[model samples]
Target: MTYKPATQDQLLAIRANAGIAELAQSERYAAAEPDLVEAIVEGVGQFAAGEWAPLNRIGDLEGAKLENGVVRLPDGFEAAYQAYVEQGWNAIAGSAEHGGQGLPFTLACNVLENLGTANMALNLLPMLSVGAIEALEAHGTDAQKETYLPDLVSGAWSGTMNLTEPQAGSDVGALRTTAHLIEEGEHAGKYRIKGQKIYITWGEHDLAANIIHLVLARLPDAPEGSRGISLFLVPKYHLKDDGTPGARNDVRCVSLEHKLGINASPTCVMSYGDNDECIGELVGAENRGLAAMFTMMNNARINVGSQGVQIAERATQAAVAYALDRVQSARAGAEDRSPVAISEHPDVRRMLLRMRSLTEAMRGLLYYTAGQVDRGDIGEPQAKARAEVLVPMLKAWATDTGIEVASLGIQVHGGMGFVEETGAAQHWRDSRIAPIYEGTNGIQAADLVTRKLGLEDGEALQNLFADIARAAADEPQLMALAGECAAIAKWMREEASLDDRLAGSVPYTAMCAVAVSAWCLMQQYDALDDSNDADRKHAKRVTMRYFLDHIVPEAIGLKASATAGAALLYELDSSVLAA
Candidate 1:
């Protein structure tokens, strides 16, 4: 069954968990009145359902294709993208100075959650564009901003990040792409860029009139490694004096990757300066490309976290719909012992509840993280540091949870889920890439323990644990979970070796993420009062109870794995370990 966008109620509920009301209080988002935000939410949900959801299966089955140096999306994919642009959905979170609606980035996160749930593959296009906006906004020169920001913010021209190469996936410093100063020509003072970038999302798509490639390349006389690389804006087409796309540039999509899923979004092998004519301009200060790229990367990281909630919501919905419809063997409690829906079975109910509760928790994590980003933007004290601390773990934890929930979704379907026609497997396949995208979840874990933990001398994480512990103090399990994580954080900081920290990072990240998620649920639970509708409060109670009772306990039980040093992992030699 094709799943539409998550319901308005669910999106609104998750937004509440993120404290949309609090965001509106900020001068940055003062114009985002409650009614306006609600209307946007409702409209985005409807658009996702009516347009994007229908293409999910089509895109998966047909995928995007490479032809004649251009990447062609599946049928209706072009129109859907155009519709997305035409609807101004892309502009919501953008800045007003650049033709955007100036809404909160948190709201945009909610919007993408719906679009991603509807169609993750197609959704990758604009998601990258938004990241580019953040990058240029922070680093673009006045001329660069005047030239590119409006179109990108308006979505008439899309954007992409080009970092990975054949040999340089995680190591940006190892990239072979090079940029040369164009000292004496019409394009003098610009650059001639040359390199092949693989796994470039939306690199050569025909959805927009132009694609602005934010590429990392080293220059002559540059230092070795990442510190030497610079950010360059390479356009697929040269801009006319009038600012519209003009002549075609030398860049082309050499080939498209055949992936396990999200096939509708072209993962291009983009070659720049095939004819030695590709031109680019510097973005920020020389040799500070990594700093500029991290702006987009960090933005993309948080966006990637939402992919977890997207797939989980879709998978959970599909699983529940199937469970409620597929009749199975007789239930002992059924009248006359007649056959009952699979949902009535004890194990099935447990899986369904687990799916729902985890989805809720992940959804909360996504919103809360995005809200932190917004808070940071508005200059809220400590918000920026906390967002840095949260982004890595949120990416690592949420994507892993998405995979878990998607797998459980398949399990809920029993035999039918193994077959593609049922569409359950696609969610699993589509979801498999989130952990690998942005940065591998392993990298996210490493960042969480290393740099993020060291932020403000670890005061940021200390602040986060304090809030969670305060909110969760009444619940012994949650309080213990918080305390254990606090103790572990301290141990990792002062005593554990780097290897030990890395070994324990994944489990430790899962612990903090779940504890934080539980804290979010607890906050929501506490906010309810007698004036709230019974059904609303009851559903919240059940979801929170299930998470606290089942999921929190399982996460809390990871103490041993989290604190276990790296010695055991390295005890066996590489040969034996591989063998």
Candidate 2:
């Protein structure tokens, strides 16, 4: 399936709505001129479409294969990756002091959005590397950065987070991986990592020269559970005297996972220190590995949310194309009652509009959050807090939207959608894993209510609501809905029990996401108010109106359920609930 990215105008409109111009005015991002940013974004989209899009199907069908410890991707993947590296795409958001272009991280997110939409599986390799770069940049020793940052930033070597062991799913403390100090000659200072990790994405791949495995393991005589865990920089190959990749480390991919989607990207069952010589260097303070790994996980969570937007965008495009091309029954209201294309059918129109509007809103939300994160990075306290609130919503809500939109894509396809060859099924399959990973959507919602809502004693949420109300001043309907959500949030924080809060968190999250999404779309509507491009502005206007008319009310309807206490939920018999 072919992929298309947001237009330059659309991208800029999102940035404008998010107030990204403030970042450009700062000395930190002064180089991010409007035209330059637009050109770069458009160029990345073009590259994604032209290079990686072709590999989507091949990756899905061929998948990644493991043979005798080495993992391999389908043909053309390596060349496309090299093109990706050659184009300097990987260095877009890295630090200038560390071989990056020193641009806004927002633009880098845009790059990932585009590239991942084209081929999300293939994008995982570099995405993980970006997170690793972030962790090391924050915690790695100077020697570690000097040896690793150059290769990692340039995409010559990939990074993997080895957190999941077969026994430990979401519980990091349950892991049994062991690491010990090497008290020997040449490697005296380094530690040895020994254990197996499952579900390691891009754990061992042929595309990069070596894989940097960030392993979480326990040291001897340490406290048990999560506190005992320490992070290690275990590489596929040990570096030589000149800081180049040299000897093969003891780590290897014992096998590859048989997964539901993103097949081209290897999900490996990694075996570390089988020969008792998996040398690794410490990343940060001992017993604080979870903190360091969370730096990567938090980054990965947002990017995982981006997968939802990417898949939704692709699915929406596919649905729209199919709707325009596939003619079926006659439209009841048409002057000529002959059979018409599905696009002309009213119900189909609703589905298509829902897909279009929600996808656009999600795109806006992702950009808005990314832009705030950029501002927060530059010392904006409020921006940081608000971004924290938005991250869980983006991760939970957007991925849920992704699944919904992709399923709609299949529905739009009718019978053909169920078949694998149509690609609609593939989109849904790929999207299925999103909400389950990167801290499940439910976990995200719980975090929102339990943690983020309490920021500044609920003023953070109120501030956001107040902004929504201010933005919705002319639109009383949206203002009313926003108020309803605020009331629910207040009730959850002030009156509701923990059980009640947990029970209602999912609905509350969806409600807040809808309110925030409306807030985002409102910005787009405002940004396009003076646009000379008639079609673009009209599209925005209609979609905004569509969301207000069709979607916002559904969220409004969620108020009652959102406020419903945990009584009914707990009353259910366990056997019956299971049955």
Candidate 3:
């Protein structure tokens, strides 16, 4: 089955509902007219479906290999990456000052959706690089930007965030990586970093000339825990005084982890300063590396959420195609009927709709959150806060939905889905990591109920509820669900204890996502004017109804689970479960 990009009607509907057009009209993106945006999206879709999708199976089958401390990608992987760079896709939303196109992030989101659906593992390279470019643009010294940003934006160089270690996974403070200032050498004033970092994606690859690593290590006299941690810009190869690639840095890919999915993406264990000669420059202030790294992590989180949307879209497309082509049982009520496509079966149709509706909802939430990010980039304070508040929900909910939808896609394929040949299993395997990527879903939910809820004395959250309420006001069907969400928000803020809130944070996040997605769909439904094509409008209307009737009810169960408190969670003894 061929991969399909979102329809013109769907894209237009998303843009209209999410205020992407208004963002385009802003002075920052003045050149992003509707036609140009549509054309760029279509071009990317064509490229992704034609070029990247074909290599997905091959990449999965062959995966990446560790040969003599160098990570070698699967066949055709390097060529695809070169074509990606040559096409200038990496710079679509990058800053123009650094050789980027300076387009809006919303446009980038569209391109990435297609690319990721076509090939997820390959898409991760640019995704991580974009996050690195963002961090450098935000905190890198002027010289650093001048030396690194151009190559990163041009895709000639790739980037990696190195924070995890053998013992420090989420507890970044427990990391043992150390950096000492170089006293006397050509690289004096820089720090010589030493440590082992694990789970480093694309840490070593032949796709790029250089790999710019944003590493977190402790400086001498640095305090303990997260506050004492600092960020460093460490390159795979040392840079010459002329700002070109120089001697090989004391960094090596010690090994690669055999993974269940995204095998094409090299997950490496990197040893820095193996010879005590790896030089790294400080990024922000001393003992503030975590803060600087957050810039990259936050950007990566959104892209991870977008990954969820992408994989779900891909799975749904495959499932629907399979359902329409595979013949099985006859129609239930028809006498003397011949066997028909499984899509004619009620259960299969139900599964297809589940995949379709959830994918659409996840996309709406992802793009809407991205629009908030774009507005925030343009210095809208409220928009910034809103984007911050929604980031956790966006990451957790969308990824969870991705896993569920991918599993459903496999279910739609019956026995074939269980086998590696069907390709349905790959999506499920690939999506599994998204919940754990950037930060685990558990961490995201905890952040939602704790830090994000406390922002602006809860004004950010209140504003979200108000927006949903206002959007639901015009449509009576959405009112009850909107009210339920409002009640949950209030309970979360005023009634639930902190521990209780944490207990239900996952479900609470889901409830919020459902409400937000419902609002997005309602906006699209209401925006369908008579001038629009009838069939397109009708399809939107039907999807909106299907979501309301079948999917929105999940919010109620989520709300109940969210308010259930932590008592039952810890009541049982640990030994009972073991027995």
Candidate 4:
């Protein structure tokens, strides 16, 4: 991309937000040792530049294919996954007892961004595996952990989440899959699963030795609807007592889906119990499968948000690179023969700067969310709650921003972005599913509205406003922006119910994200004020000024409209739809 450094003011602002600097100053990145920080960041940069960079286009082109009931990834996938395992990248946030490095999730967030920025599709397997590891660690039986986790954490095996069925997608209550108690009371504890599951990610892949399918089904004698559902661990191949693959299990891949994006990650239609004899072991308890699945679902949602960030970053880099090299129209006052890189144009610069601001700001927000996670590691009630409040916000905000940033990237490339070879078009298509999958963005908004908003009668949101206000207290310009955010927070509290409050929830959610991001950037500015890194601090100030001047006002308008209500968008006449 363009190599020009940020201006003096912009540079300073970034130093203020460095993870290490925050930790040293207070419960921040400094929570980890300096050498550890350096090592992790270096590893992330290397992985992104080395293995991931080259295979991006390769994976998208080759995608994932189904053969003999197995999903085959792109050409370089096995090698890349092996390399990731060798580097211990998959174990970054896993428990140390299970062959992991035991690093904080926040520490891993930057690495996640780099991986995604390098290639999102190829990284899907690892991401899903990590979530499965979390679920197993949190709720799996001791035997289950011993049998599954070492391979999963070591990246020797992969995992899949099975929640969707033909009749059931988001509504889990509609699930038809049945888990009948087998052999009466002899093998009564065990169940036989019978049903088809679709849209399962990393469902039946060849990238790893064995695929663990976490299937949710209902017991024969259990109550109807969601209350009767139970989680089962159904392996692709039955494991011998020695933990080796013995024979084929009853589960099989019926087909692979041809999708819009993330082509390298197989979205499968899986059939369970073709012979009506799939042995399935229970996880947690019967009728509590939804709760168990949630452990994986929540992590997946956050990872999906990171996916959005990754695509946006890639799109921005591509746009910036293209703009800097492509020569276009002459300047208004220049000689007739003179030409300039497209970036020199006013509109192009605006789009580029806007893309940069949103991307950086979103990254800043995500990292801050990570930092909160780190802070939660300190083991305090308030710290834990603070981290909880940010999770849903981060999940919703970053993914939505991903969609917006990627679309803007397409705009920057003009018509070329729509074509196949440019690589810009693929980002747009790939990012579309992030919001829809991993709990739709609408679900995220509802979560923020219903759960996060009402925390302690809105005290959590109130405290959030206080933090924003504190960050902007020194500058009059930013103070106005902070006040606007605070006013919106007030409106949120005044709104009657969850549904009513979320009437304009999309913009309101965006407003919260952008406001918090600006706060983080401002905090970075505060931290760097005393630093010797003059250039870094200067660039930061300019960037911050630009954000406050050009960007914060839009958030102001969003807050106003969110407070106003959503009749216009919702109340349109049915006759208008006929056209």
Candidate 5:
């Protein structure tokens, strides 16, 4: 029998057991005026199938092209983008006052997963725009918000975050971009930015009439290093008071990067001040660019994590479809002339099932994390604290799992996986960026160790362990898996004794992701079993058991290595590494 996604009613019942419903009804959710959870889920399923998924290969093969300093999107992207804008998807999590749908983070995540599953490259522009919106909402003046929010939310305009410079890849302090105050009275109070930004996604595109670039630069008199940096909003084209694009802004795309994936989304080398009059308005207080950018960066990090989930889900589905149809050697009791589907083979079945289970667990973790984000914004002080602490964990684990799951999908296809036409390879290539981007999984693990571990005088880490303990304590079925999760979390706290936390951090991040995902899956199992929806209940239990038995042990090994510390990687000489 063909396997279908558990129905919405069943998913909701499963979610309820995972504490999703209670979280939705919490004060924080109410305050956000977040859309009903059911609507969000329904919208996601429809959008994934109807709008996004069909574009994956089309966008990948016919990616955006750079011509005469302008970017041209793939065929059908404009129409698909139009459909997305019309649906008001750009503003799902935007503040209500800005003509947004005012949905919660959890709902927004649901949509993002679908978007990623459909076409990650196409959705990059909107993803960046929403992060910019959040940054502006958090820090921009009323005048700026009044001027930019409506167009941004309506998708009449798009946005990008410009943070990297030639000398400053990960180190913000090394940036040399300069933002001098314009001397002319007409442009007074506006800064003229001059520098180059590299590897900027959606930096220069014609998908929208105007592109709003939130750039970071240093004032002439500002202090050195990171303290000297400041953020600005530099649009692609100057807009009239009526909000229509007018004269071209000095910013222009120098060239587009030929990347390993996401070719459909233009990654450009943007020159900010070639004309010497690129007008930019200050974002927040001076010398606080990194801090202000963090708001956008963190939001983007989570969104990127969701993208990883999307790719994994799509790839897993595609692999399963192929497995059940592709004929290979016969299974036990089958005759030589009667070859069975690849899925009939035990090894192939194991890989495909692992891919499905991991993808599901990842989705659950992302939604659960988003629920916490909603709570942090509106829940009590303690709830907010808990949510804040979980952000890094969620971001790290989900993205890492995305890479693993996508890779497993490729493995299920055998030799055909490497062929681009199969579409399996695309997922693997695209997923590679997830762990490397969004602050890198290593950076995420370092954060977990240095900051999050010692939070609340070491009580925060213990609280997380306690929650897992409590979840496992009463449920004998989950006790072993939950204990493993607790053990890994404990090892993460003790990783400080090892040298060079960053070296072994990525694997640790992946391990943590697996453990945490298992914990969340167990919660889903509890939810489904408690609900009246029998199919969903059975499905959740089976999936949870699959994850706990097969995936949880992966974390146990990772914990062993993380406990071994970063010294091994550090010992490898740069000369030897290069050789």
Candidate 6:
């Protein structure tokens, strides 16, 4: 099946909904123009379909290989990556001060969506690099940024985040990795990092000239737990006197994980300072690694949400294509009719509609969230706060929905989806990890309920509800959904017990996602032009109505779950669970 990029109408609607034109007037995005943004997204879509889509199956089959301590990417990955770099795609959304094209993050999200749909595993390399760029740009010292930013932004060097250890996982405070000050060597004043990091995506690969690792470790006198952790910039190869790549660093990929999906992306168990020579420079301050890491983590969480949208788009497209091509049973109304395309079957149509609607909803939610980030960059304090509150929901719900949509795509294919040759199964496998990465969905829910709700003493969430209410006030179709969400938010706010709030967090988060998605879809509906493309505008309205009718009601059950309290949850003991 031929991969299709987001249509011009969809991109324009997203831009209008995201207020890209208004943002362009701001000092931060003065260089941004509507035409240029459209061109960029279109070019990205074309490039991805042409360069990366063809390699998706090959990447899955060949995977990443670890031979004698070196990591080699699947066939075509290296060449494709080089072409990507040469095209200056990596610099599109980077800061102009650091050799970037200075585009808004919304455009970046669009690019990522296209790339991820084309080839998720290959897309991960740049995804991690963007996170690292954000981290270093925010927290790295002047020297560190000068040394790394240009190459990283230029895609000559790639980056990775090293936070997970076998013993630590999400409990970053439990990390055993330690960094001690080096007082007597050429790298004096820097720290010598020693220990291991696991689940490092694109951790060790030959795709770039260098790999910069943003590592979280503990200092000697640092306090125990998360409060004591510190961030470090550890390069794969130490820099020479002239700032060129020199001798190898002490970091190495011990082994690669055999995973259920994303086989082309190397997930490595990285060993640092095995030879006692891994030198790392501190980023931000000592005992503040978690804070610095959040800079990257938050960025990654947003991108990860986009990944969900990406896979859903791909699966939906593939499923629709298969349904149109594969002949099956006759329509229910036709008695003596020959077997028609399964798309002619009502159940298959339902599945395809479910997949398409959810994917559209997710895209709306993600693009809106990305717009918030862009707004925040332009000195909007309220926008920044709203973004912080929405990030967790975006990450958790979008990913969960991605998995659900992919599963539906598989079901639409019936027996064919279960087999590897059809490729539907791969989308399911690839999507399975999104909920677990960048912090598990459970953690995201917990963060949304506990931490995000506390923003501005709860004013942030209140503003969010108010905006949804305002958006729905003129549209009768959305008012009920908006009211339900507001009521849930009110109940959550009044719930005093931490455990009670935590128990209901996941559902509450999901409810918020549905509400926001509905609001975004309405925005698209309002912005649609009947004169230019009447059919497309009508289709948008129909999709919005379908989403509200079929999917928005999910908020009701989710609300019930949110207010269900912690009693029933704890009623089952560990022994009972084990049994």
Per-candidate TM-score against the hidden true structure: 0.98, 0.98, 0.97, 0.91, 0.92, 0.98
Under the 3 Å rule for N, CA and C atoms, how many clashes does model 2 have?
Answer: 0
* Candidate 6 Cα outliers beyond 4 Å, as residue runs: 474-477
Candidate 5: TM-score? 0.92
lDDT string for model 5 (1-579, tens) is 122332363245226423455665665455332245665666766765677667778888988898988788877788888888888877777777888877576667666666767788887878889888988998999999999998898787899989888888878789989998876798888999999998888998777878999999999889989988899999988888787889998999989989888878899999988979899999999999888998877668778877767777778888989898899877977666578899989988888878778777877767666666666676455555665556677677877777788888888888899888788888888877777766877778788766766677667666766676677665443455445545655655664553545555656656556656667877667655556877767876777788877677766666566656666766889999999
As for TM-score, the candidate ahead, 1 or 3, is 1
lDDT tens string, model 4, 1-579?
Answer: 312212221222223333544544554233456566666766676777688877888788898988776677777888888888888888777777788776667656666677777888877878888777877887899999989998898888888888899888888888998898776763477889999999988788777888888899988788888888899988888888799877888999899889999898788899999998787888888799989888777557667777876887788888999888889889667677588898988888888887777766766676666656555665545655666666676778888778888888888888888887788888888888888887777777777766777677767777877778777776565566666655666666675444456776777777777777787767766777687988867866776666777777777777666666656555777888775
Considering TM-score, which of the candidate structures 3 and 6 is the better prediction for this target? 6
Better of 3 and 6 by lDDT: 6
Residue 491 lDDT, candidate 2, scale 0-100: 88
Q: Candidate 1 lDDT (Cα, whole model)?
A: 0.88
The regions of model 4 sitting more than 4 angstroms off are 1-31, 183-188, 335-337, 475-495, 530-533, 566-579
Rank the candidate models, highest lDDT first.
1, 6, 2, 3, 4, 5
Q: Give stretches of model 2 more than 4 Å off.
A: 573-579
Candidate 5 segments exceeding 4 Å error = 1-14, 17-20, 23-28, 31-35, 333-337, 474-500, 530-533, 570-573, 576-579
| Model 1 lDDT tens row, 1-579 | 666665644554545566778888888889878788878888998999889999999999999888887777788988998999999999998889889999988888878888999999999999999888999999999889989999999899999999999998899899999999998969999999999999999898788999999999999989999989899999989989999899998899989998998989899999999899999999999899999998888879988998998999999999999999999799867676778899999999999999888888887777777878888888976888888988987899999999999999999999899999888999999999999988899999999999988889988998888888888767888888888988899999999999999999999999999998888777666666643578877887899999998888898899999889999998899999779
lDDT of 3: 0.86
lDDT of 3 by residue, 1-579 (tens): 678777564475447655778887789987778787877888888889888999888888999999998888878888888998999988899889999999888778777878898999999888889878988998999999999999999999999999899998999999999999988868889999999999998899989999999999998888889989999999998877887788899989999998989989999999998899888999988898898999877768888998888998899999999999999878899795899999999999888887877777777787788888889888899989998988898899999999999999999999999998989999999999999979999999999898988799988888888878777666654667667766776787898888899999999888888878877777766667744588977877777777887777767667778889999988889998788
